[model samples]
Target: MTDPLVLGPLLRHVGETTASVWVQTGGTATVTVRSGERSWSARTFVVEGFHFALVLVDGLTAGESYEYIVEIDGAQVWPPAECEYPAPRITTLVKDRPTRLAFGSCRTSVPHDAEHHGSHGVDALRTYAMALADGEVEWPDAIAFLGDQVYADETSEEMREFIGTRRSLDEPPGEELKDFTEYAHLYALAWSEPANRWLLSTLPSSMIFDDHDIRDDWNTSWTWHEEINETQWWHERLVGGLTAYWVYQHIGNLDHDALAADEIWSLLAAGAGDSEVDLTAPLRDLVERNDRHPEVYRWSYTLELGDCRLVVLDSRAARVLEPEARHMLDPAELEWLAEQLTGDVDHLFVGTSLPFLLPPGLHDLEAINEVLAAGRFGGLPAKGAERVRQIIDLEHWAAFQSGFQEVFELVMEVARGTKGDPPATVTFLSGDVHNSYVAEVIDAEQHGAGSRIVQAVCSPIRNPMPKGLRVAMSGFSRSLVRPMRWVASRSRRIPDPAYPWRVTHGPWFDNNLAVVEVRGDGLHLSWYAGEVVDDDHDHPRLREVSTVDV
Candidate 1:
């Protein structure tokens, strides 16, 4: 029999009474998910010749551990026959149990061998897998991959070699992904490592895509959209990127209610049978429409775990590119986000790919750059400023002032107990800055006895920023921007932030992964880096870089 399982069997959306498992198959097959005495089976659906199934297993008791087996057409294909480690188990959330989550971003797909260690470093996720396998660390409730899950635009040497065997590298956008098939290969390369693969199978995961998932600086500006749309291959690239993301990442994110309400799933359910349903045309059209009009479909989601709420924002796709009214999240998305940012929970975790609270100096710089890029200086200077914006990646929350203020005010309101009973902490968990840091916002008026607002950033799970760039960033954030802030405030004519903030921890540049635990009224965060101790590259060790409590 053919190897039906291609990718996943990834555990997702584990709720009180329901759970979802996503898997890719080789052909039309019955995908079965078995947990204890309960089992659910569903036939795979086809999209652009790729077979996938999202089996929702019901009747699960909350706070219980259930060992699961995935089978395709009556043959056990997961938890490999020769496996020595513990079998994959789904542990549902318990009401009184504290919530622990692992988060990081910007992982590159490269061989784990010692030769590639210098370029890629040891994969922190892989090392975490080793710790989990050995029972050295407690498994998190879920792993939130903030963004940059796959670098579609930046292919590695191995990826290039694989592309060359299948397609000509001389074509436009050569070496980068051109279609769905290439993206499939990219995901395979990213998740196929033995240790990481096992970790994914058992652990619940949530993800969002950043620029690299499509192309670098995706939707950075109106001009960027125009330029990429003019490219001959962009149509296929956009469709493939989004469609694959839905199949591989987005579907599993929804709870039972949301999944049942989804239009695409409704269509797929209507056509479920022995034969695979061809959804290429409809799926492509959906992606195309969503690209042009982001409000047509929502990518952001919220999870209520115990006494905390995790709000994962889709900062990339839900953008308003209108020059005069530019915002990271469009009106509909903004409203949705506002609804989710309530004070009912003990801890409010806002997960955005780009950080909400950057270093004050850096934030000032970006805000100033935004005014200049808006033709404040006019003519060639404005043009140059625009180019600089793209070059230095200035398209963050601070660059979009209106959106930044709106969200900031809302967060402040929540923290001040204006929305409801205040959370103990309102923490912004983010990645993509290539460095890890913690910053706390101090309310000028000492508002209410509400939440302590903090920004915690952990990034580059495998990729590392260059030393020169790190030095420059540290220097600019430390001293240079202090003077620039005065000029920026004067030029932009915007008042100072109501609350002043300072970086309290880090600016560390190690390839790292971070974990956050929420207990009662306190939160603990720690960063870990993978180290090849004793020259055993295969069995890399995880070293704790720093830990902070708030």
Candidate 2:
């Protein structure tokens, strides 16, 4: 029997004309996608020695549905013969008509039960979202996974076991992923949830990777990259992981035009011929160079939804790490980002893997990190410098101060309606910090501006922060964090403005899921946590956290 083929990042566009489906598997497979009566097949491609497919179906109507399937070794696969088709199995992209999108990231397949279940739990979020999309609940316009969709550093017990079964964990890379095979299995764990798989078959998704997708702190600084590259297997590991990430996750996010213009895309298209081509070598070189010199390419892009615009920023992989001009977004990427947000739109949504604003106290700690990172504290001793780098690796938006400041100022312009025809609302949807919360930009009048700038964060649909770290974060946020920001700035040694963040919305506690609805005059955002009831879960409930009025 042939291994089942899996598809993901279902999306539609290109003149309300074409649809694309990304597939990965143990071997080559044939995918058949149908929109209404039209059907299509994608030529197979390989990256990092893994076989995958991208099928594009043409003649789709906007806001409509379609069905698709896969066949390997002359056997039909996907939504297995016995499985039921979810509602809206395939949908054409639509405009600003109350789009219900489900988005979150940072998932680890631990036991949903309290027994610390050893087996990787079925993806609860994926399951719920699928069932909801199927019939249990309503479907969303799109699904956006902000970051850490796969954990390269923190593998689950099951993943560890799988790795151990395949190779020795006592080696230098020990328990850390080091090649294409390891990365492949990591993806299997990530996408194996049936509901999530089903959801992927239908819901158009936009994904951007975070650190855990590669390692704990993949690229916080030049030093981190240097250390990792110095390791015997680090080069292979980074190259393989990033190449697979690009082939698997990143490419699916684009439409036909973007894909057509991509250099790698052209290579893959050309390589679709009979004799096999090794995409890994060149792909590896590209990823490695991207890490070392982020300005060479553009990983960030913009998505237009009728009157609304979604600007997905590449917080990682596009950093300017020179000591003098450290930044989260390289100059080129920042320039592009600024230009995108400057465009006139009704609603502007910025998708970043890292939250732009943390709790006020934590925001202050980030400033301290800047000083420490600058070697301003304790004379930047060897030990202290390593420690500071680690801190920068841990939280983001501060690691690249110049880039962070530039993005901040740009968004602030949109929030204040600095442009002649400003976006009615500037909403940022992000994930990465294991916990989730919502922050609204308070207007001078203090009413949650309806279309006023707002931020909604949802994280770890499966992953949970350790209780100790959670406690530390809470205590630090409430007590020492704010004071330190004040004292540090007042001392004038490394003065940075204190965060004007007022938690008028929440500091909600939980490994939760969230949803945001954009109606005419208001924005409705809510969160839910997983609760196992009767051996299953019913915790995907939406509890209103807060509302903002313009």
Candidate 3:
């Protein structure tokens, strides 16, 4: 019999005593996850013509592992017909054990064939999956997909074909995702790859969206927003992206209690037994509401991993772009984040889609652009600066000087033990730029801050920058450092960063995944890339690119 299941039996939000399993079904049906003699089931909730269920499997033993199978409407559909890999397992977190996490961003869902490999590079997550299957590395406690898991604007050939079947490609937003249906298709393309799917099933994963998840340079500035709002297609794109995100990614990130507390989720889950309750109207309205008032909902959340704390922030949304207050995060989000930054953990990790500390060279350039766009020169030049900012991707944490200063001061306070006992390592985990690296923070006054503050960036788990662009980036990181800093010094408004930083390990431009282990009082970081052995284009072996113990 054909499987009624769709994208996942994805393991999400595993804890010491519980785990959540999320899935999409073909129709209105009950989805059950069974392991040994115990089983848990949830009736699918329908939304945007799709059925999904996030089952909270309780009574799980701490620090123990269990293999599970999925059944839909009482028929075994998962571990689909002669599966070769190990059965999907959930390994709950131990009380004092440090969390091992794998993270990366910017993957495009293209075919994994030779031609695609030539264009996109080897898929790092796929290579990691194959390596784990062969027992080459330890499995991470979780994987944080920082952003760009699906590129709605830069549609792949497969996505375009699927889009064409239901909607004309010659429309206003040609080759771009049109509505909730198309966004659903895009998620399927991203997650349904055999090896990657198996990996996600066995490994608990969380995600946050970045610009490309909706459109290029999403919410970059007031100018960008005003321009896009005038377009015929922007509203649909925003609605589709946020709606699909809520159903597919955001809901799964919550724990049992958190999920139950969610307004839309609780409302939809109430209709579970009724079988695929049409959620089209509510979902559309919710997305529209969020677009107009981002402060009403937050996509950011946190998890406590033994002695380490992980805070995954929503950097793309919850932004304030008005001329009087340009911020990467709105006041509400900032206040919430301020409260979360208090420390009593061994290591504190902030997972954001955009890096907190960009390379010094790149950081200075963005700072200069912020002042230019804020009318430092004149109206005409400010207009030009806004256009240039979008063209060059200058919208980063450093671009909002006031917001950057405030957050920098907050982090500095945490490092100095103002909130509580300072953590040994204050780390920022991020990805967006096509390259990867580590940068260590330095206090200007030479004060002993008592924490190893650093940035660990990993990007492009699949997509690689084109050669010319790679060359330009490399030149910027090296040749333009001094010149950029010199330019930034002219603007009194762009003050020196709270703490200047320098790249320590890499600027490697490889399709890569970075694994970080919270080992005692420090972080053990490693970056791995895929190397094709013996011209085997289909299978790439994991190769260690760099390792840093901080």
The residue-by-residue lDDT of candidate 1 on 88-196, one tens digit each, is 9888887788999999999999999888897878899999988989988888899999899999988988889988988899997798999899999899999888999
2 against 3, candidate with superior lDDT:
3
Itemize residue pairs with steric clashes in candidate 3: none
- Poorest 10 consecutive residues by lDDT, candidate 2: 538-547
TM-score per prediction, in order, is 0.98, 0.89, 0.97
User: For every candidate structure, what is the RMSD over all alpha carbons to the true structure, in angstroms?
Assistant: 1.3, 3.4, 1.5
- Assess each prediction's global lDDT (C-alpha) against the native: 0.87, 0.67, 0.87
Which residue pairs come into collision in candidate 2?
100-140, 425-451, 448-549, 450-549, 450-550
Q: Per-residue lDDT for 229-280 in model 2, tens only?
A: 7889877777877887887788777778888888777786776665445576
lDDT for each residue of candidate 3 in 246-334, tens digit (9 for 90 to 100): 88899888888887888787776676465466767887888788788889888999987767888999988888899778988888999
- For model 3 the local lDDT of residue 312 reads 93
Whichever of 1 and 2 has more TM-score, that candidate is 1
Ten-residue region with minimum lDDT total, candidate 3: 442-451
